[model samples]
Target chain A: MSYKDKKVITIGVVRDLTGLSERQIRYYEERKLIFPERTPGGSRKYSFADVELLVEIANKIEDGVQTHEIRKEMLRAQKKQNQEDVRRKMIQGQLNAQFGLRKGPTS
Target chain B: MSYKDKKVITIGVVRDLTGLSERQIRYYEERKLIFPERTPGGSRKYSFADVELLVEIANKIEDGVQTHEIRKEMLRAQKKQNQEDVRRKMIQGQLNAQFGLRKGPTS
Candidate 1:
């Protein structure tokens, strides 16, 4: 499927991918750990990145880390990733300017 | 200090390294999630790798993964890392042999 048209995964698909139980997944949602979208029928739909994050979370808990600490670290990691993305975009913009591409107005 | 002679860190050290409370670290030990060495005085001592694992575990929980599921994934990841290490060693041995080093007995 085209990137935009790729289907969002159901809760069952997420469970299978992450090897987590439905109850556990729902518990995570209740904890506000993940915020999957919902269908009009009230079923949850997870993005692929969400499933990957679940896998990463599973890996962390197995190592004897506490839940609250894990939440903090995940947020930190996400913020770091965002910063890296911004840096990459800035570098790309510089290269584009060198190549005579008119700089679009900075967002 | 050489790697082998580096002092084993006490439970307090581990707590600081992992950003976990003493009670939480003890609870993890009770769950058999970690097996730190004990001092003659009955205090827990953690290796650097053990503390690193604790950090990894904390990261996972923050991502909303369940504890048991995290445990399973951690084991899988550990096994994969071990296999990769073995493969690297084998490749290194092959390269050494090509450089005129005699093949050592296989472990």
Candidate 2:
């Protein structure tokens, strides 16, 4: 796991970082907008990435965007990104094949 | 917009391309999973990108993933990807500054 993926930050820290209330954070979690890991004692532990996502979610909500619409837009953007990645990799693979490289393609 | 974003394909063509029933495609639209443009005569039109997205949505549904969960996962993945892109651009900017480049960093 990367440093941002480590779930070591508490909800209070996230609340301070994102300027969102505790109840609001919990509500986002209930709506499946954010997923924080659960501690052994059942406390919530959020990652750095989750904090950034919460800030983004809050910004969209403040701009009058619904949570569901935000989710859908994200999905569509991700689908486009995945397609781009696949296309890039395919081109890289063909380039490598043409250059007689076994595996790695030169950056 | 790119070629993939042009909403020129009809639902029937998308059905032929994706093997999805018309009703199923319309249902996904109703659920706000896909957004197709409309013609002056009120015909639904989809883009090449939308067709690809529909196929991806179908695969996730067939794999027993709930639509909401799939959307949430996509949002999180997209958030991570945006962060990566920002980091990459920042590094590129720093490299350009070091090289005294005024604009357009070389790829």
Give lDDT per model, in order. Answer: 0.68, 0.80
User: Clashing residue pairs, candidate 2?
Assistant: none
lDDT of 1 at B65: 69
Q: Model 1, range A1-107, lDDT digits (tens) per residue? A: 32222224556656655789988778767766677876656777665566766777777778986667778887898899999999999998888878855657756
Tell me the deviation in Å of residue B45 in model 1: 51
- Across residues B1-107, which tens digit of lDDT does each residue of candidate 1 receive? 43222225556546655788888778766766667876555766565567767777777778986668767887798899999999999998888878855657756
| Pairs with steric clashes in candidate 1 | A58-B70, A60-B57, A60-B60, A62-B71, A70-B58, A70-B62, A71-B62
Best-performing candidate as measured by TM-score = 2
Residue B17 accuracy (lDDT) in model 2: 68
Give the distance in Å from residue B41's predicted Cα in candidate 2 to where it truly belongs.
64
Give fnat, all candidates.
Answer: 0.00, 0.00
